[model samples]
Target: MTKKRALGFGYLPQESKHHFLLVTPRSPNEDVAVYERFDWDESENQETGIVEDNLRVTLDRHKWNSIKDFLTTSFNNRLKENDVTVGRFKIGHVPIERLLGKEMVLLMWAIEDSDPQLISTAIKNWSGLSREERWWLFTMANAITGHADDKRGWRKAIRFALTENPIDDEDKSQVNMFEMFYKNVK
Candidate 1:
């Protein structure tokens, strides 16, 4: 296995309990980000890493091109705020902030099973949502259908809201659907 580069958002490299976005490069422009959920367990030792097969979102060149600028810019800004050297790269095990991990996973979950052609649409809708909105949506989804193997419930609902529902005249169709789902999640 190639040594993966670690991108930190809110935690240091030593933090093992937080989630990770393992970006494995396939080619110059192609890579797959495996979102691994690492929950702390009392019985298990932390030295041995535990990577739950949570979500695999393949970001091809096109998809990467669509969101690269936004992601790099946003992440770099966060890194600077964390008092880390800006634009530094490292190898092996990417560590993302807990909330950032949730946001990224939520976006990945939304488009995991979507049509490849409609990625731009999904990304557009995702970008339209504020960080708080994204975090809230992730919180709701993670609370119920957050496990690596659980792929229904809020997960399915998120896919439907972002991918199936396109931009509308009001622009709140997707957002509205998210609110509606939140209300009906019981």
Candidate 2:
């Protein structure tokens, strides 16, 4: 029997394979590029770890900082839950825990083309969202524009809703993310 692992929202119980996000930081670590790769044929892999990855998004150091703390805290918490040792993210591929990959990708899609100055705002709005809400947003985004390179449709809508429209913390509690997303799309 396959071992069942704790998963995040919107994930099927049977989907337990790990997805990795590759983070490549330029010299001086000014600009960072993040990529996601999913392996379809695990059994075919023999020796080489090489795999094709989609370029999700690139973040400047400032923008990366805005979300780093949140990712670190939440990711580490997830690792602890799975009885894995939490470690710092070096300049390489980081194994995303369960559905955290979805959350990270969704957030990145929202701020990929946004103004760097507004990243804090995006992070604030993103952090206010419940995990289920984030998962739903990710699902919709992935359904239409899951590819890292795709910048239109749901990807654009996510950016518009998350960065351009700032939701106050109090209002966020009552706000429906789906409605917000649809408003942007429409």
Candidate 3:
């Protein structure tokens, strides 16, 4: 029988683990681009990378109402502080739902930036709504505080209410609440 040639195994050495390169290309006019590369075995936790940091706060049924109340108050306070006039008279109408999300995001960023006073203001303002209201408000708040486009954000918020799994039975009940609120207003 003719001796069979070993396949392509000998062509290249085994690739090393934990080797990752992140590269940014220089402008088109530039001939050489600078690149930074990292090569180190990541630990299990590093690989996982603190999943909790990415997790949205979980508001169960018992906590839902209280949280909602707090957000409502915060939102109202922010509206007042900003002096945003809404109605026919140009008097400020509290966009409580909108404010809640903005305040929360601001507060979160403030905490990250080590601004204790802002955090305290947010907390104090947030203490107004009932827990259930606050929970619903948070979902609304996330939409507004997320992207800059208000109309797009509102639509997204409505979609999220219709789709994403809610924290509890109470949350599930609030799914159609936005639609109802808008319908009644119109």
lDDT for each candidate structure: 0.62, 0.65, 0.31
| Superior candidate under TM-score, 1 versus 3 | 1
Which pairs clash in the backbone of model 2?
none
Q: How well does candidate 1 match the true structure in TM-score terms?
A: 0.63
The per-prediction tally of clashing pairs is 1, 0, 15
- lDDT (tens digit, per residue) of candidate 2 on 25-104: 54656666654545423455411443434555666666667777777787667666666556555554454554677788
What's the TM for model 2?
0.69
* lDDT for 15 (candidate 1): 54
Which candidate, 2 or 3, has the higher lDDT? 2
Lowest-scoring 10 consecutive residues by lDDT in candidate 2?
A: 4-13
Model 1 lowest lDDT segment of ten:
84-93
* TM-score for candidate 3: 0.22
Q: What root-mean-square deviation over C-alphas does model 2 reach?
A: 6.0
Instruction: Report the lDDT of model 1 for residue 144.
Output: 83
Q: List candidate 2 segments past 4 Å from native.
A: 1-15, 29-31, 40-53, 81-83, 169-186
